[model samples]
Target: MEDVISLSVGEPDFHTPWHIREAGIESLEKGRTRYTPNRGFIQLRQEVSSFLSRHYGVEYEPESQVLITVGGSEAIDLCVRSLITPGDEVLIPEPSFVCYVPIAQMAGGVPVTIETGPENGFKLTAKELEAHITERTKLLIMPYPNNPTGAVMEREELLKIARVVEKHNLLVLSDEIYAALTYTQEGHICFSSLPGMMERTIVVNGFSKAHSMTGWRLGYAAGPREIISLMVKLHQFAIMSAPTTSQYAAIEALKNGDDDMAYMRGQYDMRRRLIVDGLNEIGLKCFEPKGAFYVFPSVKSTGLTSDEFCERLIYSKQVAVVPGSAFGPCGEGFVRISYCYSVKHITEALSRIRAFLEEL
Candidate 1:
């Protein structure tokens, strides 16, 4: 096909807002290019602290509970490294973002994958979580508003898991990068907001998804002071500071980017409904995604594995989507369709997928 559609990419389609770009440009022109403090620029950290507390009701002291990293990815790495020792077990719910397992492994920890399926709405249930815990379990990677599945844990659901976590004495590494993209009627609820959970949870969030600044590489982690200190020490030796221009741009994002987020979220929300509805209408079983910009639809009816389905669709129809199996084993019969494209692109892609599946 001369023209193709891709639903595999994850970043927002919108460009960084002009004012945020201008802030970065201003920083560059002013020769503010020196390395910031290892933890991060104080102003940016303060802005992040305020943003988290204001938006998520999680209070983090700017000086001690926050550390700016290269991105949410690096923040995750720091948490796993700071908390995991050799042979320690990290519990990860499957059909998740791909980085958690390898990062835990690189940190000298073993990753134990728990299969979470559509029957549970792809959520990590309290019983499932409790079964996975042992004295060896050191960390749990809570990735919701999830990446491929777009599953979000509301407050009630999180509270159930928190009770189990408290019983097991587990430390949680919560990835909230997509918190701003949740679509449920109740909206997104951070695990940190649950009672008795914030003290034991390390939260990773960023401007990438919320502010359309992925390429800028600005993200941060917030938690108790002691854990944050260890993360900062690791950050100090590994990387002295995050990007200077990105940090300046992030300050602008925190201060004046709410409108931009609302506009972008409105667009993604529209596309999210369109794609999920279209997939269901096409005979694919799509779990209504309540958060993030992806639709994880079951392709089992197509008589093909997730990888086979993706390959055939890409080759035959020139519509690219990622195989859900790439996320984890439980994702075998599904595929992740990202809504980070234009409306026209989403419509065309869904149309092509429909035609392709009908042929089967």
Candidate 2:
């Protein structure tokens, strides 16, 4: 624990940009602390709508199609519960974020895992989706610019997926939490922006990753007004509104935070290259991640399970990283390292990881 270098946290090391924080402070100073409507402040919702339309060409009616929640996790839960029924199957691609399966199960839906791997860039294929389809299958959770693995789905690939989704009449829970952090030249493509997909997808995005506002606890889901109405009803009973200050902060973030996000993304891109190269040189066989701030490298060469590798690394070298298996079983031979820390932090962690590998 002493002098340990951690590359485990999937959060930006950057502070919320001054202007955005100032807005929150200004809101409080102005005595704007009363409870907002259950669906959140209408202006924030309108800003979210404008942000989505301008950035990704996905348009939603701010009044009825958007529901703000405590965070992306809450938005995701609302989506699952709003659509899933007992005995229905929810298709999830793994190794991904840890929440989807549990959320679906809690909604009385069965979680069906579809394993994706490096051979296909960790993307869910149309063939795979078709194969998994059954009468009981009701929803597909599309987590792109994915967590843990840092894989991104391109528009062409998404088009293929959309075809299948339309054919099967399946609804998609498109989690775009990391959409703004992609490394591609063309940038992120909103799934709902694809033709015929807008009405079929619930888009979940938040300020936590892009604006470095995880502590703010704010997020929103936009989609068909019918589905959003259900989620809003649920949110009203469970959570009255997202944090008032956070909502105020997020308004500023959406309006003027693009520069801040881009700056942080550039830093993360630099760190991403460093860690990927470092792990490969250390013989960990890392895949170059194209999005998000994490690298998932195989630890199989060390002749250890993912859990074994992470535990041994932590105890022996005081370096902490998460075992990929914690995301899903298909992740068993890998470990996830976050590049959201500083260049110095990532460099030192890489050095220690190399030393640890040499010891083994």
Candidate 3:
């Protein structure tokens, strides 16, 4: 624990920018700590609307379409709870963020995993999606700029999925929480930008990953007024409001933090290449990740299960990475290594990993 080079964290290592922090501080200094509206402050919601439109060309009415919540996790929970009915089936693609299955189960919906492997760069295919649809299928969690695996979908690929969603009348919870950290050449594509997707997709985004506001716990859901209204009710009864200071901070992030996001993104891109190449050179057989801050490297050649590899590495070499199996069964032969750390930190971890592999 004392000397571990841990790469298991899934957040930005950067400090929240001073300007953003100042906004929150200024709000407190102005005595702005009262409970915001159930759907969050109107100004913040407007900023979210403007931010989404400016970046992704996805428009939503600030007053009716956006509902702020306590991080993307809460937004995701609201989407599943509000939309899912008992005995309904929710289609999820894995290895994904860990909450989808449990959230669906809590709503008395069946959680079905659509396995996505490295064969197709981990992007979900139309064939894979269509095959999983059932009469009971009601929602699909479209998590791109994905966590754990760092996969993202291009516009064409998202269009393929849009067609499937339309044919099946499936609603989608498109989690774009990692939207800004994408390494794709075309940048992040919002799922709602696809034809007919705006009506069917609930876009969940937040400030944690891109803005380094993990502690601030601010996120918002942008979608149809019908759904946002329902989610607001749940939020009102349960959460009352997101943190007031964080909401103020996020307004600043959405309004003037593009340069900050761009700077952080460039740093992440460099670290991404560093870890992916290092893992491949060490014979871990990692594929290049196109989004997020993590790399999924296959440890199959080491003749160890994902857990065994992770445990042995941590115990013997003092290097920590999450076993891919923690994400899903399809992730069994791999491990997730994060590159949110500095270059020297990553370099040391790679060296330790190389030594660990040689010992194996």
Tens-place lDDT digits, model 3, residues 261-295: 99999999999888888888989898899999999
Each prediction's TM-score against the native?
A: 0.98, 0.99, 0.99
The residue-by-residue lDDT of candidate 1 on 1-360, one tens digit each, is 677788998988899999999999999999999999888889999999889877778788888889999999999999999999999999999989999999999999999999999998999999999888888998988999998899988888889999999998999999999998888888878788898988999999998999999999989999999999999899989888899999999999999998898889899999988988999998999989889999999999999999899999999999999999999999999999999999899999989998998898
Tens digits of lDDT, candidate 2, 203-265 = 999999999999999999999999999999999999878899999999999999889988988
lDDT of each: 0.92, 0.93, 0.93
Candidate 3 TM-score, C-alpha based = 0.99
Worst 10-residue stretch by lDDT in candidate 3? 4-13
Q: Which clashing pairs does model 3 show? A: none
Error of 3 at 258 (Å): 0.3
Question: What is candidate 2's local distance difference test score?
Answer: 0.93
Candidate 1 RMSD to the real structure:
1.0
Model 2, stretches more than 4 Å misplaced?
A: none
Taking all chains together, the TM-score of candidate 2 against the true structure is: 0.99
User: Which of the predicted structures, 1 or 3, would earn the higher TM-score when compared with the native?
Assistant: 3
